[model samples]
Target: MQKNSFLTLSVAVLLVFSLQVSAQDAQPEAGVTPSSPFHIFDRFGDWARLNLLTFNQVRKAEIKAEIAEERLAELKAVVLEGASEDVVNQAESLSTAVAEEVETDVSRLDEEGRNIADLTDKFNQLSLRHQAVIEEILEKAPAESREALTKALEVSKRGLEKAGEVVLKQVEKGNLEKERAEKIAERTIEQLKKQVENRSEALKKITEELGEAPPELQERFNAKLQLLEKELVNVESNEQFKDLRERIREDLKATVEDAREFRKMHNVEDEDSDDILESISEDGAKVVERVEKILSKAKEKVAELERSVAQAQTNGKEIPARVSSLLDAAQKHLTEAVAAFEAKNFGRAYGQATSALQNAKNGNKFFEDEDSDEERDENVLEKIEEANKKIAEAERKVEEFKSKGGEVPAEALRVIEEAKKQVVLAKEALAKSDFALALRHAEFAKKVVEKIGALLERARKAVNSGTSNTLRVETKTEVKNEEVERPANTASSAARQPQVRQVKITAEGFLPRELEVKKGDTVVWTNATAKPSWPASAMLPTHDVYPEKGGCIASAFDACKGLAEGESFKVQFNPIGAWKYHD
Candidate 1:
């Protein structure tokens, strides 16, 4: 009996409401014609209707609800015209409220608006219950997702609260402020949307992994979602309805497309939901087209990167890692390139044009090409070999310089300096058995041949710039902090002056581990490392040892244990001298 009565009344109410709406759509002045999309308003009447309602109060409220419903119908037409995202969200809200009103009024009509408070409380409790469920889920979330969930939950609550506020404010807000308040409501609705979308996205990911959800389960879930969304719109302010509806529609469309993609990729063969898969296939093509557009833009960026590389080289600058960009473009172009090649569509092609484009971009963009380390090793080996060749060449040049009768060629000096550096590095690398590296260092030394060319170039530059071949080395006043005892080895007062040096000596396995110095020209050392059986100090008692004191062993610090392992020692070589001492 109750079901039959309820059905009959529902049909009558829906009919009455439908006719009223049709009348309003035909006439704009009767109610607000929605200019914006998606407007479902949370009514202020519920707050006012909390009081117990007499029969007369009930009748008055019913009249008021019908009037509001009429206005809504008019607004529906307005919103459907071209409702923006903001408007769609708001319209849905108003629709939800309308639904709620019908549901409640069926139980007991309230045209007089006397007793809506209890009903409002009931719906509010439902909303709170839903929030509690969300909060519980958040509490159990893993650490990685907890932060995002917390932020989203807080924002969503705010959005709901703002929707409520906009509804309350509409009653009191003047015409001028109505526009401003509606804007606030629209933004609030958008925030709610973002929160829901993120939640749905995460849920979709989980569901995808689980394989096909049962048809019954999907339908149930969808039904519950629709209910929840309807409630959400009803709770939001009426002024925000248009914007709310628009946002919801757009979210729904995008969400469907996204879900379809997930289904296409992860669906089991012979999966359930033929309808779902069909929808996915259709929407996925559109999404792919959109992605292709992005790829096109990326290709252009790669081209521009190439141009930048060429420009940089013209100015002698290093290349950039548009390396990644070039690689991406090559991959993208290869899609079509391979197809074309496979079909023998010889479009003036040897390799894909994209490869050349990529190569062009790569030309100036200096990067570790795939085997860069191997190449570097090869370079090192080459440099070492060159250094050895140059050493022999320089020895011959040294004779040539001397044969020029006391004019040591500057070219010879420069080559000597370079060869000195190469020799030091080679010794270090050799100690490490980095033969490949050692060889490279040796090769660099041979490049000393180039220094002869640099010398003539410099001479030419000096002639061009009208500068002198020799530059002056000026002597400045020097201060001495350490005590200095001058010797008569220097006849001149100037030659006897001490020179201070801050030198970092790395004789890792050698004696006299480190040295500190001040202005002076002499040094002495006490034997510190090597054999424990020998009295170290006694072996070289007076410290008159020269670098050659121990047979080339002086230079071969690693072989002598002349330096001890894990023993740190330092010395003060103030009044600096060649100071060559050995133990």
Candidate 2:
């Protein structure tokens, strides 16, 4: 009886131990359903999804490929247009390489399907190439060149939409699937293991860093964990899982931040810490697509404006003065802008040209408004023009007459007489208010007078024929023997003889025309005559001398400094005799 009781106790103990193990295996207490907040891990169930995680990389590569193709096309255009062969070839080679790289990226998707790092690196390199192509095209093409830009923009936008679609697909591929119902179960088991390990690690780290945890925090955490384990097999509420994830993540982040802050406060030296520069570049194709859309819109607007302006101009039956002026201004601005652009005064030129274009458009719009009376007095205009032309001709004739000597030929006088007769008749008509007849007669009369005067002047100048012989005079007390010996046949009509150094000199209308002298003789002269001794000219003999266009004497009046034209310039010669002098 004693042996049997002892065996029964051992067996019962073994059965209880087995039952506990079975229950533990049956429920992990952290099993999350698809509807649970921690259901994000459901997609990670498949071995293929877990291992082949290069979708991010693939998305990035697709963008790069799109950009590369865009560049290759641009390069091809340049090459076709007679660009440097080497550059074209280089572009081709690069395109080929990029193509291969893209192919390699796609090929390796099976091996590294969700690798974000590979995608990022490869995408970066490809993106650079893509950007290079776009920049090259943009740089070569003027900003106003819309066609190329439009096409490029369109390509970019399409690429972006496509890339977004690809990325969405990639994210979907990383999620829970219909075929993997057991994934949730496996994740729950893994999460439990992770939580235990993390808890142990945190406790150790907290102890080392903070020296100790407050008693209250430890007790509360322990209670929460116990309660969480009570509903092991079944999830009681969705918030429970959500709260658990949040509380754990938040606690960890806060702990790390607190430790760092504490170290700083205590002046602890932690050298391993660094300021990490994180660069998260978007996919190239997507960026291109967005930019292209903007560029395309701009292009369309510009085109529409151009077309509208052209149509407006074409529709104008007759351009108004104000509108024409505005157009002219616009053209000038455009021309200036083009010149500026050529000279590389890029900013100023662009502003001027754009302003000019806008002004032109405004002018065109104004011209489109029709409000002009297309009526004119054609006969009146003709008569007025004819009268004006006759008057102009008369003025020209008068000028010609003045240019010659004041004389009129007989033929010209007769012609003038006839014109006067006609003028008299016209005046009679004008008295009766016959404006057209009066104007016609007046024009004839004016022309006749002008022609007569011109003819008279020409005849006078022809008749005079004054001698061209230039004469210069020199005077001295000691006369030259050669001058005395000179033939007295100066002119048959008028002759002058030197009366043995006895010349009674007197200045009339002006002082003697002498600039310098040192004669050893005292002489006296008076204002003896009103007329000038020499025949200067018929037009202005006494008032002024030469044709100095703008009026003024280069030298001041000689009264203060020396003497005026009417005054005696006293120069008492001291010793030697100075002969030649000029005014």
Candidate 3:
């Protein structure tokens, strides 16, 4: 009996140990929380699962989308739980990894001649859900966790954009039925319209909360609201909706800037004041780094301009005195920026850097010889055609207005006459082979034609409302012939133009490991690998070995995010030197 008891006891001990090991290894379907000790094991489990599906690309893509959803859930959980910044960052990183994997898998599946219409549609819906969830999380997240959550939100946005692109490509390829594509486009437009409406409502609330803003602030808000109203009127196609979305995004950024100014002006303080201050401090450091990078690029541009001037002189072309003066001014500003940056005066450094960049751009304009190039001639011709089209459209709109019993304002008629005159001048300049002058006149004509259309649109609205018969045309100064005269560059300066260099990233690593490129040349890194890879400046994790700064991390040379298969990232090499980087 004692022997039997001993055997039973041993078995019991073995069972207990087995249970313990299983408990340690087991992970939830949605993955472990960031604070869990088994988090690493959960990640390892994900990797192992993905490896098992290597032969089934579609299945892999589906699994990846599910995994991305899990990561996104974890992100929301951490934010809602008021997790520490480190935990939030970890969650964000996890979400980013899975999202990138999904992106790469979709790309690979498409490249393999497989039908990915359904898969891309799935991803698109998933991304939209993720974006909504992230926006909700943003509202409730702690201030300290906002930055990480914001990054996670960006990842979701990128995923959404990529999936949308793929879906559109599938539609273009006729992989999806016409009805289904139309449905997809309609759904996308509806979603964007909802977002625009939400933003407008939020802005209205902000205005109400502020009670009384300065006249200029109120004017700015009104301008944005009016622009949004205009954008909302005619967005029927995917392309038009895309344009509207970008415009809304830009307006959102402007709104944020306006809010900051309002806060500073009123010395606003709230529960989040301390957090805002801390965030601003961090952003200030980034700003300083960005300014320093800008100065560095400005210096390189000035050097390039100098070389161009020397080349022009060598070719027996007269080097303009104003170009040299601008270059000198740029150099002086760069020096001042460097000193300000060293002194940790970020505001002054930013101003100096901006001035330096502007001066360099002005100097570089002297080297733009559009008249000497056939391609430029074509561009001018296109501009003239565009202007003529606008004038025709405006004339048609005026007739439509008059047919509706609306009277055209005298100013509107005058503007149309001026547009015709400008078009005539543009044609004359084109015949003379003065492409720059031709382009200038064409642009002015287009602008005048647009104004006339706007005037007619207002008049049509008034007539519809039975408010008035005459169009309201804003009084502005007309363009003069003398104001259009600008200096043109010689043909030799075109030789100094910047070129693009391609670098491929394969499974082995960056192809050609080392490369020689001139200052101002842009290098595009394309990923040909099966997996996602990040191309960053030397020193690994920190990525601070490069002289330039202001990337997502420590150096401007960094791609900042993983490039999926068939994806690409580009950066201009401004500071001439032997730079080291890795994937």
Q: Pick the candidate with the highest TM-score.
A: 3
lDDT by residue for model 2 over 1-583, one digit each (tens)? 9999996775555444323432331111112222234323322322122234335555546544543453455454543243454544444444445455564554466345553333433333343333234433532343234234434433332232222222322334653232231223223323333443344445454343333432322432332222112112111112213334333444333333433443343333232110100000212123223222323333343444456556756987444455556556666756655564454333224334444644555554443434332212233334445545554565566557657533333345445444545555554544443344445555555544445444555454433432111111212222244444332223631344322221122431224433232122333332234422221212232124223332233211111232333444332333222222212
Number of the predicted model whose lDDT against the real structure is largest:
3
The lDDT values for all models are: 0.39, 0.37, 0.59
Ranking by TM-score: 3, 1, 2
TM-score for all models, in order of appearance: 0.19, 0.17, 0.35
Measured on C-alpha atoms, candidate 2 has an lDDT of: 0.37
After superposing candidate 1 on the true structure, give the runs of residues whose Cα lies further than 4 Å from its correct spot: 1-298, 301-360, 364-398, 404-494, 498-547, 550-583
TM-score of model number 3: 0.35
lDDT measured at residue 6 in model 3 versus the true structure, 0 to 100: 93
The true-versus-predicted C-alpha distance at residue 321 of model 2, in Å, is 35
Any runs in candidate 3 off by more than 4 Å, and if so which? 1-31, 199-206, 211-583
Q: Please give the lDDT score at residue 55 for candidate 2.
A: 52
lDDT of 3 by residue, 1-583 (tens): 9999996775555444423433332121343678687676555555655574245778668767766766777887777566777887788787877787788877777767677877787677667656666666664565566656666655665565566556655756778765565555445545544543444454454333333232222333332222222122212223424444344544433443444444444433222222222332334233334445666777788788878878888998765566778778888978876776675444345445656776787677767763445677688889989989998988888888778555675446756776776787677766655555678788877876677766777655643332322212111112235554222222432356767888899854577655655445688999997778787664543333244665564566677767899999888754323455665
Model 1 worst lDDT window (10 residues): 470-479
Better model by lDDT: candidate 2 vs candidate 3: 3
